[model samples]
Every structure is written in structure tokens, then in C-alpha cells.
Target chain A: MSEYTPFEMIAYTGSRVLKDERIVFVGTGLPIIAAMHAQLTHAPNLYMIYEAGSLAPILEMGMPLSVGDTRAARKACYLKGLCGAFELTQRGCADYAFIGGAQVDMYGNICSTIEGHNYDKPGIRFPGSGGAGAMAANCEKTIAIMALEKRRFVKKLDFVTSIGFGDGAPDYREKAGVLGSGPYRVITNQALFGFDEATKRMMLLEVKPGRTPAEIQELVDFELIIPPDVKEMAEPTDEDLRLLRDVIDAEGYFLKRVIKK
Target chain B: MINTVSSNIKNISTLEYKEKKFEYWGPTPDESRKLMVNKSHALKDKRMSLKEAVGKHIRDGINLGIGGFVNTRVPVAIIHEIIRHGARDLTLSFQSNSICPELLAGAMILDPDRVSIKRVELAWWGYEIIGIAPMVRYLATNGIIEMDDYTNYGMSVRFKAASMGIPFIPVRDHGGSDMELVNRGKMIECPFTGKNVYLLPACHPDVGIVHTTAADMYGNARIFGAYCTCPEIAMAANATIMTTEKVIPTESIRSYPNLTEIPFPVVDTVTEVQYGAHPGASYGYYWFDMDHIKMFRSICEDFRKTGNKDALKKYYDEYIFGCENHDDFLEKIGYKTLKKLKDMDGGQPIILT
Candidate 1:
């Protein structure tokens, strides 16, 4: 395929990660696009649960600009409200939590609330956890998308908005009264990450073609479990790119964008 | 008291916060119950002006639960009225929202005494797909207002608990996170199973504002798009101020009682205002006027970045304060914009007959 933008790559990677016939509790923008692309190509039965309370909606209208947009609620199998959807996740119906965050730790604890130490005031305040926290907590597994930056991949998050493996402890989530197994994948443009089962620390599983483990490590603030068997990240096919651009995000909503420094 | 099961999350995040005593943000469960008992439950004609509804119930130091998820079916017209009427030291409660809170924040920025937000108990506050809420960033980062964050489920369940007339409800989220520590929820060992469960306090707002797809004169609302915590907020509040896209006949409502998401008793006042959630979307009626939302958002953003209120004041003067009613504001928006938005809806099926 021709050269693609970073966002297209992320969406493509997100699409590739999903398994068929499972429910994915999706956040707005890229996650929705990724899930749509997956349905169009590979995982046809992968229904989506928008946080605003619609399950398995047919996206015939267009790409919903917001998770709560009327388009997200069009022709749904079930539609209620936030309580109904999240409660379903808590009840073990949702399979994957497709989310994004501002900062993350080695254990995959995400911080989307604020950036500074003080909870009252912060250096920078992003949006609070809309559904990411509950999704990460209750959905069987979590898949996070992040910009691979040293500052974002921190030693300790300023505030943990989503529960991952706390302190790399095995019984952390169990003790926390949460139902999910916890953070399964962290997707970035440069690399794909999975947590080590024994240690529960973020481990590098794959790197983009022509990118080395050392190069990816340099972008991160914390140490990574870089195994020697790191595979090359798959590039999107031309068909995938066409579906993303021509069909899904034709309005240039999410796919056509610049990453903020 | 039961022994608390620890997530062992202490000192995980680089956060410093004072421990807050557990207290209801609004009315206690008992007080809410007392108010409900004393009120008239008759199916009287509750139709009134937005000005009267807002002015009658809105005041300083009251919890205001707003409805809608982000922009869809948001109570923008009611928000405009609240901003115009002016309510100070308000506590906002919602699961996730965008414009309603932003509009209030913009009003507060223009004149603090006129409209001030003391704090917000929320899951999220930002314009999804549009941009981050500039006002939340400006106010929160600068320590202008206190914030208590929860997951969207936590906030919704809090209202659900209140609607059920319960003091607290157990949820399967918000345990191993910072919200467990920062928010007013308590983690207690479940007496039944001996497992840890987070119990969040019920949220009963003094007044709840919501915009719905259709309603009768008695205020039994039927929401077309995502219900988005509207019914819960209305029932949980001591009083509800509601606006509807169209007032369908009560006979139509009675024919299908199952369609009424919000029964009439919970709602104190109902106002028929078409395109009520304009700038936002109303299912079967219209789609979002993205340009207009962007226009208002950029205005707020400009004031945030530049520390100037000239443009902000102009917005209030022109769109809000200058117009006496929602129809007047819609007139300023004109028929062309309304028509275009309607065309975008593509006639999603909603029953009014």
C-alpha cells in the first residue's frame, strides 16, 4: 500500500486486534472507526456497545461523531442508557474494552483525568474517564490506544483513571472488587504491547517494520520487557486503507488528523 | 462496619489529595423522600415557560443534574434559560455531557456572581470528537471549581440509586483506581459474599433539567435516542424542569404506556419547545449543527486561551440574554439552518401519534 498517516495505522492495528463474534465496548473516534473497519473486513460479528446505551447498532447513517450521537443509537438490538450498557459489561457480556488515555504506567494503569500531582489542580487536565474506567474494570479484557511518547508512558501516573494490574500484583483486580481480568493490549503506531502474565508488566510484543526495540524503548519513560522474538507490526492493506478513508471516515473526522506533540 | 478489602493501590499514582468525609452532594435520601411525600401528585397541566420553571426551582447552592450524553438530546434550550436566569454556587451532576456544562461554565466566566459553578460530580466533561472542553481545562487546572470524578456507570448508578429511593448502590467498578480514593464512594466488604464491593452514594439533585423527544402536557416523556440518564435524573431530583420537542396527546401516550420512559409524577414542569436540543441533536427531528457548536466552542476556547471576555460577552448578549425565549433564539438561528439540520436527520422513525 501507499504511505499512510499515523492515525490510519492505529485504526488498522486496532481493527486487526479484534476477534470475531465478541462484543467490544468502544470509546469515541478511532475505536469506533477501528471496530467498523473490522466488521467490514474480518470480524463481521463483532458487535459494538456505545457507552451512551446502544448495543449492536447498524452504522448505516454514518460515522457517529460522538459515542452518544444519534447515529450510534440507530437500529440497535438493545438501547437503554449508560447504566444499562455498563451494567451489561459488569455482567460479563462485553469481551473487549477499546479505550484511550493520556498517560500510562508499566502496569497499564491509565491516567485520563489530569497530568499533575495535585488532584485539586493539575498541570494539564484532559477529559475525565467517560466509560474507560468502568470498561477497563468490567470488560473481560482492555485494549488501549496511546501516542507513544516518553511523557505519556510514565513511571507513575498522575491519576489512575482506569484500573489495570495494580502494582503488578496478581490479586489486585480481585481485591479491587472489579470483574475483568485486566489490561490485555496497548496499541501504538510504533509498537504493540501486551502484559507479561507472570509479572503483569507491559511487554513489547511487536514493533513497526524498520523500527527496532531500542528505538521504541527510547520513546518510553519506563523499562520494557523487550523479548528477542519481537515480530514486525503488520501494515494495512490497500483495501483496509480504502475502507478506512473512502467508506468509514470519509468526512475526515478521525482518520485525517495530526498528532499533537 | 465491615472490614475494607484493599486493592493495595495506595501510593501507586503520583497523586496528593486530602481525605474527604462521606457526605451527600445534594439532599439526603430522607429529605428527598420527605419532599416527594409532601408534593401534589395530581396529573395537572404542568406546562409553563422555561423562565418560570428555571426561576422557580433554580437557586444558589443547589445540585443540578443535567441530562443527555455529550451532545445528543442535550438540554441546550434549558441550559440557555438557566444561564439567562442565573444560578450561583451550583453543583452539577451528570454521567457524561458536553454543551450543557460548557454553556454554564461560559456564563460563569462572563459573570461569576450571575452564574457560578461550585463543583461538579461527573464521569466526563469534554466535547467528544469536537475537542476537549476548554472551560473545564481552564477552570479545573486553575482550581476555579472543585471536581469529583467517577466512571460513567458510577454516576448513572448513583442517580439510579436515588431514583429507587435508596441511599447507596453497589457497583462493579471504580475500585482499584484513584476514583476509589477521590470520589465519595466507599469500598466495603460485602456481607453476603465476603468480597469487596464499591458502594456509591445516591445523587438527588435539587432540580434536574432535561430535553426529551416527545411528551404530553402532564410531562410523561419518551426519549427516542440514547436515554442517557435522563429518566433517572428526573426521578432522582426533588423537582424536574423538562422541555420536549413536541407535546403529543396524552391519549397517544396512554395507548402505549410502555413508551413513556419518564412518568408524569416525577416531572414538576413541562415546556413544549421544538428543536429544544438544537446545536445538539434530537432524534427523528434534527441532527447537530456542528458549525454552530464549533462556533460557540471556539468562542469559549478563545476566551480561555486569550483571557479576554469580549467575544464571550458578545455571545451571551446576542444568543442568550438578548432572546427572551427559545423561539426567539431559534429565530436568530433562522429557518435555513433548522431545515438543513432536519434534512440531516433523514427521518429516523419516532412515534408522536
Candidate 2:
């Protein structure tokens, strides 16, 4: 319904990962945006629980500055504890766990932890692992959405803080003892992929609207199993683009990170 | 001729022809009002000690107001003093949208007791696992505290009331049906003012403590920059204690009167405490001692695994208690150790898992 920028289209792909009437474990940044779009679209029944204890119904536009963003509070049903999301998911009350990715692997395993080899030594640093360790092992179904490019999609993570694709095949989920099958989906600018429920290996399902499977494949370092049914990703709906633009209230430098030329 | 006494004696009392000297009891010009001079006594006052002060002012039932936002401008030295004394059972109130690190020092490091409050609201800084977001969760699930939240505007409005010594302030915050649950939940009370009004209760601390860059002998404090509502809270409190980075001559500060925030008339005690905002570094003085923070986090993580307070205590004793002061603590968490942390891993990464 609306003109979609490449960025908004990526967000739409992230949002489309959510099914109607699902309980979502929302993370900050892009994940928050995706969940909000899902709520605005066909999945109005989609319920979101953020790290700050907000179980939001209607999320405002833009990336929430933090979990305590007014939008989260404004749209939440109840503000519960932080681990309550995990507890709810553990109890099977929740259906989907949506998170973002700094570095993701073919196995769906994630590295939200350290950047380089040494504990003290680092090339790039971030705040240490949040609740990802627990959520990855426990959530019913996990979805990881990353906007950054291949330097982020590493062959092997420095640390396996979140078990997306771990070990390999049955051994990965088996090693994780994941109550529900761990991370199910991985969404990137290039392609959309899901782990085979049986083997727990990633299967490429779709590509971006303009890009070819071959073009997307070369950028990633890992082997991707392209489904014969792969199709072009749809453009972001009008609401999706509007929300994305509104959330990123940028003035100069910061605005440039996500906006187009 | 002056002694020639006569009817002119009365007339002689006119203006003196020769210069006459006048003397006064006050200090001499060289000794000016020592008000500008910096001064300190050992933390000797009974009620003024960090522990006793927190105990005396903060009772179980009343909501406690802490000054400082998130990590940047936290009153760390005071918090440590409270921890050392082990004051428990508090419903801490904050005016900021999110927390900084110093509060974590309280919840995770010092006091194991749960913080009881109506809301755990902040503007930002709630997403981290090891930070306030997770700590709040652990407490709430265990029924340690209640979550009464307000948005950024609501927090400022309410804190303004507390600082002003008002019982409650009505604001146009939380104004939608989406806010109905919180309103009905009694966290948000709406009075029938014929307009959308939310009544936020006033928060008063028994004793308020703040750290300033400088103070005079009389305890008039001047924060170098970045003034949060600490001064306002000080005005509303029954008594205020200040720990200054250094004490200076009253006259010296008088030369730059506009820089002063708390006048001596409002102050009770002043201590020349260096590195008073430990864990939280001064704005322009230094970046956060992240290496030290990581050590604190590592110790906290170890405690989290064992669920043992003794381990935390041991860590505190080894690192914190062993230090003579904040500098001593900083020395032990050396730059070399901080440099080594990066080598231990690739480095800290911000993955979105």
C-alpha cells in the first residue's frame, strides 16, 4: 500500500516472519520494529513481551530507544519482570521468540557475546550477553533478524552466546536440550531461511525483491540450501515504511545509518 | 591645642583633621572569612555516616528517593557506604527514564534485599541482561518489589513534586485506554479533575547525599556541571550531606559565585571525598572505569551462579574493602588488567541473539 525503501522492505521481511495469534518475545531495535509491523498487519493477535517487562499490543513507530521506551509502556498489557518472558516461554504460554543478530551462523547459533579470540582482547566490543543464552535454549520458535551485512554473518562466531544453529543437525538441538526447537528462522537483507525441523539445518526459503539467489549466495561465506520454490520478497507495506521512518527520528549523522540516499 | 578644653570641646568632636586608626574584632584582611577555604573532618558525625544516614532517613514504609540518573552521575560513594552498613527494605524511587550503573551496585553487589516499589520505570537503559532490566525481573518474580511505571514526562513531573515537598502532582501522562490496566491496577490513580490527571505521590528522602566538585569550609557545594535534581532533593530533605571532590577557600569560591549550586546555609556536613562517584566516574574527569565494572560484573556473575552472598562479600573484601579509598580500588583494578580483558576474547560483541 505504500512506497517501500530497501530498508523498510527488509523490515517487512522481518515482520512477515511472525504468524497471526502468536506470543512474541521482542528484542530491541529491528526486532521491535518487526513485531510492531506484525501487530499492525494481519497478526493483530500477535502479542509482544519486551525485555523491560512490557507485553505490548500496539507499538509506536521507530526503533524503541530502549526497552523502557514510552511506546512499550503505552502499548503494554502488563509490565512484568524481565525473566518473566523466559518463564512464560518456558511454560509454553508463548509461541515465537523474535530477536536481532549481531552475528549469525548457518546453524542458527548466534554470537551476541565477544567479538574476537581473547576474553580481554577484542576487535569490536558490545555489552555482554543479555537473556539470549536462556531464550535461545528455551523459546518455542526463534527468529533472528540482522540488518548488517556479511562481516556480521561470520563463518564461525567468537562465542556461541545464543544457540541458533549449534553443533550440527540433531546433535545441536540435542546438545542444547532445547525444550522447544531452538531458532527456526533467520532473516537477512539477502535471503530468508529456516532450519529444517528434522535436521535442524538451515534451508533458504526466499530472496529479496530485486536480488537473485546467486547474487545473495556469493555475499555469505556459508553454504545455503536454496529451495526450488524460492521467490522474490515482497515490498514493505505503507504502514511498515511509515512506522520505520517515524521510529528513526534522526537529525543528521544517526539518521543516515538506516535511511536511503 | 586639642586638650585646651573649652566650649569648643563639642566642636572638636567634628571630623578629625589627622588620620585616625579604627580597629575591629573580626579577622584581618590577610585572614579573610575562611569560608572559601576547603576543609574536612574524618567521617565522624553519628547521623552523618553514610550507613546511619540512610538508616535514619529511610524507613520501611516510605518511598526512598535516590539522586542520580543511570550510571553517569550516580552517587556511588554514598551508595557504598549504605551497602557497607547494610540498610535494607527500601522502595527506591527515581526520576529518570532509565537507570545507570550505580543502582546495579546496590541491587546486585551490596544489598541482597529486594527493592519494593510500585514501578520499575526508566526512559532508556532497560534492555541489558546484567543491568536493571534483569535485576528488576529477578526481584519481581520473587515478589521483591512491585512495578509501578510512568513515562519520561510522568517521572519528571512526579519528581518535581517530591523535590518541591508536595504530597502529589497531577499530570497529563498515561492518557489512553491502553493505560487503563495500570490505572485500574492502582499504580496510576486518576482523580476526577474533569480533565485527564494522574496523581503521582511525593517522594522525600530522610537524608539526601550528593557529591560536588568543590565545597567551602561551611559545606556550600558546587557541582562542576551536569546538575540532575540532586540540589532540588537536597532542599526538600530534612538534612543534606555532601561529599566534595575537594574543599576550597570560601573566598576563592566567592570570586566565582555563579558556579555555586548549594549555598552553605542549606548544607549540614561536608567531607572532602575524592572519587566519590566510584563505579560512576565524573563527567569530564574520566570515562567509566569499564575494566573495574567488568570485574564487578564478573564477581556478580559468579555470585549469580552460586547464589551465595559470601562469595560476593569475599570479592568485595578482596577488591573493595581492601582499598583504602576509591583510588585504592581503582589501583587494584589496574589498567594492565583492563588491557588483558580484550585479549581474553575477540572482544565484547553486541550480537542480537
Candidate 3:
């Protein structure tokens, strides 16, 4: 019906990944918007656990400034301490954890640590891993949401801030004593990627509309594992965009004005 | 070739190296027990001025824990006092900080040559180096303060271990990341399961400061919403300082014993400072003063651009040093604005049915 923003598309895609009645471990930014969208839309029974310990919050009004925002705890089912919230993940309670990172490698290992190899002397230091590492290690599955850029999609992360499929081998996480299976899908601006079962390397699953495989290849620094049955990513429908704009992000705090023509 | 053995070999070697290099920094289990036993004698009316609390307890080179997650319920008033009193060589330990750590690092409070105080050391997990507060990046980039990083969960569990008076706690997370490499903890076999687990050592700060909605004159504190790590921090720290919106009578606190997060025995000082968590939200009391926070950010940005402390000095002078105390600071915020903020929310705590 109307032109939509890329953030709307990304949020819509992220919402689509969630199933009904799943327990999602969500953080502040875009993940909150996506999870809220899912709750309002298809997955009404989805339970949300904010990293700051607000569990199943009834997000009534304005978007919460942070996971620990008082609004998040306002009608929450259970408000735990930081230890208790993460302990749930450790106990294998969360069904999905939505996270974003600075860089993600072919193996889906995300790096939010120092850009330079040296920890002492970093060329550029992003914020060190918060709860993303723990969630990735403990959740049943992790969904990495980030803008698609060549710099972000790398051959090797500067540092493994969160383990996905370590070294792209089977039983790698098991051997590493990681309880979770790492990222199941990486939702990006241009496309969606899923890990190959045999290799555990990220493979191109779908390209977004109006984008070609050649263009997607050009955007990535590393070689993409292209599957033969790769299909075009479904664009946000009229209803999806309507719900996203009207109900989910009514204030357009996250999805509004972010998209550039 | 699966190449599983090589990876396994690499991991085992790393694990062995980590174990060999592991060193505990804080008090031992026995020492912690002794300290708790010594300190857990009696509960007194620890009510004192914010100045007295900061000056008497927060000394140079003491490991400090400032409690809060992001902007909610942070000890801003206490932090301002710390800066004003010129506490030096303070080693700050926190998990998932927002404005508190950024202000501490950016305020040039740690500049030894300039301020003539010992440089501050910061050990944090998940700093607000993102869009919210990027001054930490500037501070770290210039080597203004020594920095150590940990995962949020790791830091929380460390506080839990300290509270429990245990030497270290076993965790299944943070095994494969760079956090494992840099973490002071060692990878050990869980004797029960014979599986590898990270043993995060106890973190007992010399002083822990927390701001809450209400507390009694005897230091029994209660937080209305989102009690992140304040309770754990209070239990873990050697001494706890509480700043509250109001100091209620002991009877009121006793009426709701279940809501008491920090008991009087654990708290060493109780300072009554209304709107104490200014520029930050104090749950049901008031929302975050975004304009003030923006002003803080602008000052930081000016410092970043000019590489001069003039802007920071001006900010400190006007907001912190200029004010005599929390009351003076509240005066600067203006009563009308405060009333408006308080009234906007009906001046009531959200009671969830």
C-alpha cells in the first residue's frame, strides 16, 4: 500500500522467524521492536524476557529506553535480577535470543569486542559483549540482526565475542561445552542466511526483492555458500507493514525515519 | 577430514594455558567469611549526609561497585559527590553501566597530572560505548584510565559468588569467546559432570553505592521496579551506601518486610537525597531527564572535539561542584520541572495486579 523502510523490512523478517508461544530473550534496540511486532502480530503468545530482568512485560506505551527501563517492568510477569534473568538462559529456558553485532563471520561467530586483535591495544574498541555471549551460548537458537554491509560480513571475526558454530564443524558447540546451537538464521538488509547442517557455515538462503545474487556476492567480503534452491525473500506485505507501523512501532521510535531512499 | 581433533587440541591447549595463568584478585572465601562475621554484628542508624558518606568510606584505590543498569536507579548524586570530594585511585567494578561509568571516565576525575589525584582504574562488563554513551571509548582510546572487560553474566555471577561468600562460581557460558581468554577465571572440570566449566571468582567491592525509591533511617532500602543487581551488590560489597528519595520511619519499612531488598545490617550508610537519581530514572519517582542527559552528552562531545577539559569543567562546576549537595542540585533542576515530572506520573508507584 505504502512505501516501507528497510528497518520495517528487517523487523518484519525478524518477527516472521519467531514462532507462537516461544520464549524470547531480547535486548533493548531493534530486537525489542521485532519481538514486540511478533507479539502483536502472528506470535501473540510469545513470552519476552528483557536482559535487564523484566520477564513478559506488557509493553503498553512508549518504547522502553533500555532493557532496564522502568516501563519494561511495569506489568511484567516476573522481574528478576540480572543474575536471575541470565540464569534462565543458562537453564535452557529461552527459545530464541535476538542479538546484533559489529561483525559476523562465515561460521556465524559474532564479534562485538575489539576490532584489532590486541585486547590491550585495540585499533577500535566496540562495547565488550554484554549478555549476547551468554545468550548465544545458552539459548536454544540465536538470531543475529544487522545491516548488510561488506565490512560487517567478514571471513574471520576480529575476536569471537559470541560463539555460533565454532570452526564450522559438527558437534563443535558440544565439544566446546556450549549448551546452545548458536545462530539459526542471520536476518540482514539484503538477504537472509542460514547455517548449513553439514558444514555449519552460513549459506545464502534468500535474497531480498529487487536484489540479485551477483549484487549480494559483491557486498560480502568472504565467499558465500550459495545453495541451488535459494529463493527471493518475500517483501513485507500490506498487512505486515500496516501492523508494524500502526501497532508495533506506533511512535516510529526505531522503524521511523531510519530508512533512507 | 573432519578437523575436529585439531580444534579440540587447540581448545585443550588454550584451556590449560588459561588455568595456569588464573589468578584471584579479591578476598578468599575464609577472609570473606571473617569479614562478614566481623561486620554483621549490629544494625545502627547509619543515616548521614552524602558528603560524610562519600568522604568517610570511599577512599583512594578501593574497589567500588556502583549499582544500576543503564540510567535507571543509578547513584548519580553519590557519583557527583565522589567527584566533588576528589576520591582518587578508585577502581570501579560494574556490569552494564550507562551514565555512571561514562561520567566517571569522562569527567577527567582520573587525570592524575591535571587533578593531582591517582588515576582511576575501571573494570566493567558491557559499557555504554554505543550510541547512548561513547565517552568510555574516548577515555579508553586515550589511555586515560586502565580498563578491564568482562561479560555481563560473568560479572553478575561474580557478584553472586561474593554475596554467597564462595570462592568462585561455575558457569557454562563464556567458554569459547575472547572473554574466556581475558577472564581472570580458569576453566576447570565440573567434578560432578566431568565437563569443562568456567570458575568466576568472587568480586567483593570495598564499597557499593545504590540509589532507591525509599529507605528507612536505619538503612533498610526498597526499590520499586527493576532491581537489577542492587541487592547482590549490597550483599557482596564490604560496605553499602544507600541514597534514597526519602528516609521513611522503621515502622513503614517493617510493614512491608518482603519488599526490603537491602537490610539494615548490610548497609553502612543511608543518605536521604530526593531526586537522587537525577538525569536518570528512579523507577516510579520520575522519568529520566533527557534534556540533562543530552546536555551531559553535548559536554562530552565538546570535550571530544576540542580535546580540552573546559567543557567538562564547566559541566562539573554547574551541575556537581557548584551545588552544595543533592538539595542544591535539585534546586538547580528547578522545583517546577521536578513537580511536573513527579505529577506527570500521578506521584504513585505502578502497582501491578
Candidate 4:
């Protein structure tokens, strides 16, 4: 297998995690690329719901730079507005929410709102939760893509923009009035994670080849529930890379970008 | 008042935000209804110049409901006119937007006495793919403006509820998130199912500005793209100032009644301005001008990073204050850029008749 970039690996991993014939509520960038790749390869029946009100768009106009891009609305089966799209999620039509965030905790609560504890004044202000919060609250399962770093994988989030398994309580989601099962998977280039069914804490399911679970644990601020049988993540074949590069993100709008240091 | 049922969100995040009192950011349902009842319901020709339309409704301290989700079909033309008209201490309400609010924020930064945003109630603000909105980061981080955050659905349904003449609507989101505490929404037990549900207060903007694909002189507007909460926003506002890419004949509007997103009665003024959402995409007409958005965003970012208002002021001066209306603004954008953007649209289909 040819070496792939971290974004490609993340996209390929995202595509791998998705099941066929399901709907994914996608944000811009990698999530869209992942859904496109999944459709082109294994999960042709897997459709997408864009927050700007498109469902099952053919994406023939190439990769949409934004979810609100007209290309995202092209040849959509149903196109309404934010209300129509998210109402569908709330009504249980969407199966998976593919999202990204600035910070995440062990329980999978994602933060994309702020880097500082202060709400009014912040050290750095990331974009507020546009649709991820609603998607996380209502979509049956939440799948997050994050850059693996100690600062990002923190013990505490500055803000919980998307709800995961809050406080690891069994009735946390139920009492919070959210419908999602919560925090199904956390995908990074180096590792893939899932929540423990019993504990609702993040569990290391797989790691990249030549990497150790302990090394993955080094990057995270919180302790991950690493099981003994951590398998190596599947590397994207050259064909998968071509599908991602040539077919999905032909303009290198997302796939070819360099990760910020 | 509904008693809180149950929640663990207080223990989840490390955010230490002050508890916001529950209050309507704009008109209450009763006030909105009464305002609608008092207005003339005639199907008169509401066609007016952008200047006149903005002058009539762009008042200080009015809640301005912005239409469009992120970069698509944003009300940039109206925002320019609003900047020129100069509204102070404004309250902006939107689902998600890119250029509209940024333009306003830039104007506020250039001259606060002329234009100011006191607070914003929104889901998100930033130029998608372009970058984080610099003006929002600047204003918010400096504590210059207040913000009430909600999900895209939370804000959209707030307008939807106002349009439906309801006081509040229940949703399943924001209960476990910090939005439940910071935003003016309430969490209550379901009257029927004994389950907890979050209720968002209706958002009835005092003046809603929207740019549409087509509209007649009577202000019956049609949106070809993703509706982007335009229909609800138009109906939710006390007065709606509409700008359209084309002024289709009323005969054409009548030929397809279902195509109308904002009906005649809901809209107060209509201005025919092609490329109305310039820089932002208008699905059937043209695509978003990514370069222009990038250039503007960079300028704003420069101002944010350096606290230098020269470039930002020049941009507003050259584009917004320099122009008489949207036509003048589009003229400055030139035929080539607009043509390229239109070609990029790939002729998405929409019906005029």
C-alpha cells in the first residue's frame, strides 16, 4: 500500500466505519469526502444530509467547500432548510452524525465553541456549533473526526458543543432529552476508538501499524479504556487513495490540505 | 414557568458562563401578532429601491433576522444598505451565516456610532472554507458584543415557531449541551410522554432582510436554493425587506403558487437586484465568490489580528458606502467575476413560470 496523508487515512478510516444503506449527517470538509468515498466504494446506498438542507445529493458538481454550497444541493432528493434537515434527524431519519471538534474528552463530549473557559471573552474562539450539537443530540449515533493530540484529547472540554455520554451516567442522554445512542466512534489518522457499551468511556479499538496503545494513550489527556485485543487499523490501498484524490476531492479542496502544526 | 426535570450538563463542561435569564430576544408572539394585525394587508406593489427599503426598516435596536445558511443566499445586499443607513445597537438573528453578519460587524468596527451590533443570537458565524469570521472573533473575544448560542435547528425553529404564531416549540437538542444554560431556552417535561424536551422561544425579528431568487412587485418571493429558513424568517418578522435576482411578472408568480416561499402579505418591500447575494451563492444564478470572500475575510482578519482598521474601512468605503445600491456594488464586482460565478452554477434548474 502506498503511504497516504493523515487526512486521507482519516477519510479512508471514516469511510470504513460507515455501514451501507444508512444516512449520515455530514459537515463540510473530511466528513463530506468520507461519505463520498463510502458511496463510491462500499456503501453506495449510504446517503448524506447536509445541514443547509440537502438529502441524498448526487454531488456531481464536485466536492462542496461548504455544506451550504449549491453543489451540495445539486440533484438532492429533498432540499428544504436547516429546519427540514435537522427535523429529519430529530425524527430519527439520520443514522450517523459525522462531525469534527476542537477538543474532546474521554466520554466523547466534543468542544468546538471556545478554547477558554470564559464564554463572553475567550483566548481563542472556534466557530460555534452550527449543526453538530443538534446532530449529536438527535442522530442515532455520533462519529467524530479529530486530530490526535494531548491538547485536543483533553480530560475536560472548554465547552460541550455536542453531547456524548455526559458524566458516563446511563440516564444522562435520556434525561437530557437527546435521542442519539451517543459517541459511537472517534477517528484519527493514528487510532480508531469506540465507547465501552457498559461504561460509556472511550475505548481504543485499533491503532495504526507500528504504533502502540501506550503511544496513543500518550497523546490523550484522559485515560482510554484500551482492551488487550487492539487490532491494527486497515491502511488505505492505492485504489482507495485514487478514489479519494481523483474521484472525491479532485480539486484537493480538503484531501490534499496540510494539517496545521 | 416549567420546572426543570433532569440534567447532568452542569457537570459536563468546564465553561463558567453566567446563567442567562429567559427572555425573548425580539418580539414576543403576542407583540408580533398584534404588529401583523395592525399592518395593511393589501397586495400593493411593494417594489422600492434598496435605499428606501433599508431606510424604512433599518432602525436602531431592532432584531434583524438574516436569511441563508452559512455562505449560501446570504442577505449581503440588504446588509450593505443597512450599513449605509446606519442602525445602532442591533440584534442579529440567524441560523448560520458568513458574510452578512461580518459585513455588519465590520461596519460597526469602522464606526460604532453609525453602525453597531449590541448582541447576536445565532447558531454560527464564519465564512465556510474561507476561514473563521474575524469580526465575530474580535467582537466576541473582546466582550464588545453579547451572544446567545443555539443549534442551527434551534434558531431555525425559533423563527418557524414565530411564523406559525406559536410562543415556543419543543425540540430534542440542546438539553445536554451548555446551550441549555446560556441560551434563553427552557427544558421541560413533555406534557404527553412524561419525557424531557427542550423548548425554544419564538424569535420574531423586528425587521427581517432576505435576498431571494425571484419575486413579483407585490413581494411574493421565490427561493430556488435550499430555503435556508428564508420563508420562516420573512413570515416571522414584523416587516420584511426583500431583494430578488429578478422581478418576475405576477402572472408568472400566479402560474406557480407553490413556488412562492415568502407570500405577498409577509413581505413589505421588494427590490430587483441581480447578484443580490454576490460573494454568497444564489443557487440557480451564480456560485459564491470564494476569492472575494477570502479577500474580505483576510482583510477582516488583518483588522482583528493587528487592530488596524484602515484596510477594513477601505473595503467598506469602496464597496458599501461608495455604492448607491446593489447595482453599483455589482458593477464594481465587474462582469468577468460575475460571469465566472454564473458559469460555475452549472445552470441549476428553477422555475419562473
Best by DockQ: 1
Q: Candidate 2 residues B167-217, lDDT tens each? A: 555433232211212211112322332222334444444455666667786
Instruction: Report how far off residue B22 is in candidate 3 (Å).
Output: 4.3
How do all the candidates rank in terms of DockQ, highest first? 1, 4, 3, 2
Which candidate leads the pack in lDDT? 1
Error of 4 at A228 (Å): 0.8
Q: True interface contacts reproduced by each model, as a fraction? A: 0.91, 0.00, 0.43, 0.85
lDDT of 4 at A110: 93
Q: After superposition, how far is residue B289 of candidate 1 from its true place, in Å?
A: 1.4
Chain B TM-score, candidates in order: 0.98, 0.63, 0.86, 0.98
DockQ winner between 2 and 4, please give it: 4
Interface RMSD (one decimal) of model 3: 4.3
Clashing pairs in 3: none
TM-score of 1: 0.99
Give a tens-digit lDDT track for model 1, residues A1-261: 689888998999999999999999999989999999999989999999999999999999999988988988899999999999998999999999999999999999999999899989888878899999999999999999999999899999999999999888788898899999999999999999999999999999999999999999999999999998999999988888899999999999898877776
**Candidates sorted by lDDT, descending order?**
1, 4, 3, 2
Off by over 4 Å in 2: A1-3, A57-63, A246-256, A259-261, B1-99, B102-353
Instruction: Write one digit per residue (lDDT tens) for candidate 4, span B278-319.
Output: 899999999999999999999999998899999988999899
Docking class of 4: high
Cα lDDT over the full model 1: 0.93
Instruction: At residue B109, give the lDDT of candidate 4.
Output: 88
When 3 and 4 are scored with DockQ, the better candidate is 4
